[model samples]
Target: MKNQQDHIHIFSGEIADYWIEDGILFSQSKPIKRTVPLIQENIELVKKITQNQAMPLLIYLCKSPVPDKETRQFSREQLSQVYKAMAMVSAPGLSQLIMKMVFQFQKPPIPIKSFSREESALQWLQQFK
Candidate 1:
């Protein structure tokens, strides 16, 4: 059987690709404004990639929240919709129940495995890779 690391590959270009390195999930840029359209675009992208046998994952490496927010949690109105999207993708084991539980919490105290250096993220992602 191929190790997770052996399955890792990069396809950098106009269309983004998904892959895991260590334990971190990585993906290309999703559009701004966390809107339905933008989210749908990402979902389509995930579907297209997964159809090709690539696992879908997201790794956010940002010094601050994209909107400069104090926390990573989405706003109150965004929670339900986000949950729905996650549920829609759970069929093929794309989204795990633990992830769902983490997101489902009113205030998930779970610390996002973040790192100050790309190397650190890379090292962590290696576990899953």
Candidate 2:
């Protein structure tokens, strides 16, 4: 993991800590109330990372409950512009359900999938490479 962090791009927020490793953007968020501005900031950080020619795969590790409607909507909108593929790792619960529901309602421009393990998520993302 240390090797992967060599070119890490960190985005720290009250709710989450985001970083990029080996072209995969990873996010781990706490169970804090999320607001629009905070969500937008997260998106902006992703935008900066994706500005490079090579688009990266996203691996979001959801440790918190599902975000509100607006945050989910905004994230979908912003992510569509940048990601080549998205892989989410979350337990089987509301968080996972919400993620699946969001993708079902508004299909992302890129491929997205959910996994229970980080290794599986990373392996799946390799197809986009």
Which candidate number maximizes lDDT?
Answer: 2
lDDT of each: 0.38, 0.66
- State the displacement of the C-alpha of residue 109, model 1, in Å, after optimal TM-score superposition: 12
What's each prediction's TM-score? 0.39, 0.72
Error of 2 at 57 (Å): 3.7
lDDT of 2 at 79: 68
Off by over 4 Å in 2: 1-9, 52-54, 63-66
lDDT of 1 by residue, 1-129 (tens): 113365687543233345545433355433343434444455555545445333313443212113313222433333333221111111233223334433555543322343334455454444433
lDDT by residue for model 2 (1-129), tens: 223355665777666676776667666766776667887766666666556433546455555555678877777776656677777777756446756756658667678787777788888888776
C-alpha lDDT of candidate 1 relative to the true structure: 0.38
To one decimal, what is the Cα RMSD in angstroms of model 2 from the true structure?
3.2
